[model samples]
Target: MNPTTLKLCLMAVLSLVGIGLYGLMICRNLIKMVIVLQILVKAAALGLILAGQMSSQINLGQSLGITVIVADTIVAVVGMALAVQVQRRLGTLDVDALSSLRG
Candidate 1:
């Protein structure tokens, strides 16, 4: 990749990370939090892909990438299940209402 192209890729990945971080910090809904978490993971994966592509070797560290993908999938599944349970039990997805445990 040309220098400019590589720089652009890096910037894009950084921007994605920043956006994900911002959303994670600002969001109060549980589902939005899960989505933001996924966005952060996807940003990391995007950065990895960009770096791999720039190296011209095209090697994605398949073992690690696959492991990460599998783990992410598992995480999303479990998160969805938990979110559903939380919504059912709490009647809302807002994170601020979680003080019942203090009782």
Candidate 2:
């Protein structure tokens, strides 16, 4: 990749991280938090890919990206399922409300 392209990728990764953190801090809804978490995970994968590209280890980067995606998908799915149960049982998805759970 050209220097310009590398710079662009770095900027994108940084922006994604910043946006995800901001969302996580400001959002109270469980679903929104999950979405923000996905953004952070994607940013991490992107950073790994960029590192691989810069290091000329394309295969390693691809494999790592794939693994990250798989793991992130599993986590997101489980989180969503739990969020659904929380909404059903507690009648709310707000973090503040869910914090009231004793167990």
Candidate 3:
């Protein structure tokens, strides 16, 4: 695409990843952590889309993006499952509370 558009796209990806990282480092809620992880995944997908637009191998980039999306979905499902279990066992969804979880 246009050079300006490409720069904007890259900026958007950077901002998205930055937000996710900030959330991950600062948030105490397990659910919020999961949501931030998804945000990072979305940023990755956006980067892949931009890569496809910039390079000659459009199909390759698209396939990689799709793969990332599928992997993210699987991870989200598993993460949510574990979060649910944690909530049930600990009666709280806070990251600080997870420290008390023991086998």
Candidate 4:
């Protein structure tokens, strides 16, 4: 890629990471947290791919990106499942409410 293209890709990756971090910090819902985490992981994967491209190791970058995708999917599924259970048991999706609960 040209210098301009590389710069753009880096900017995109940084934007995604910033947005994800902001969302994670501001959101109180478990489901939304999971979505934010997904965004963060995607940003990481993009960064890995960009690094691979910069290093002339496209295949390595692609494989690592794929691995991140697979792991992220599993995490999302589990997070959603937990959110469902929390909603059913507590009748609220608020993180503050969940934090108050004890064994």
Best by TM-score: 4
Residue runs of model 3 more than 4 Å from their true location after superposition:
101-103
Q: After superposition, how far is residue 47 of candidate 3 from its true place, in Å?
A: 0.4
Candidate 2 lDDT over residue span 1-103, tens digit each: 8999999999999999999999999999999899899999999999999999999998899899999999999999999999999899989998998776487
Q: Distance from true position, residue 33, model 4, in Å?
A: 0.9
For candidate 3, lDDT tens digit of each residue in 1-103? 7899989999999999999999999999888899899999999999998898899678888999999999999999899999999899889998877776577
lDDT at 11, model 3: 99
lDDT of each: 0.81, 0.94, 0.92, 0.95
Residue pairs with backbone overlap in model 4: none
Candidate closer to the true structure by TM-score (higher is better), 1 or 3: 3
lDDT of model 2, residue 75: 99
Q: Give the range where candidate 1 is weakest over 10 consecutive residues by summed lDDT.
A: 56-65
Alpha carbon lDDT at 33, candidate 3: 91
lDDT per residue, candidate 4, 1-103, as tens digits? 8999999999999999999999988999999999999999999999999999999999999999999999999999999999999999989889888776577
Decide which is better by lDDT, 1 or 2: 2
Could you tell which candidate, 2 or 3, scores higher by lDDT? 2
* Per-candidate total of colliding backbone pairs: 0, 0, 0, 0
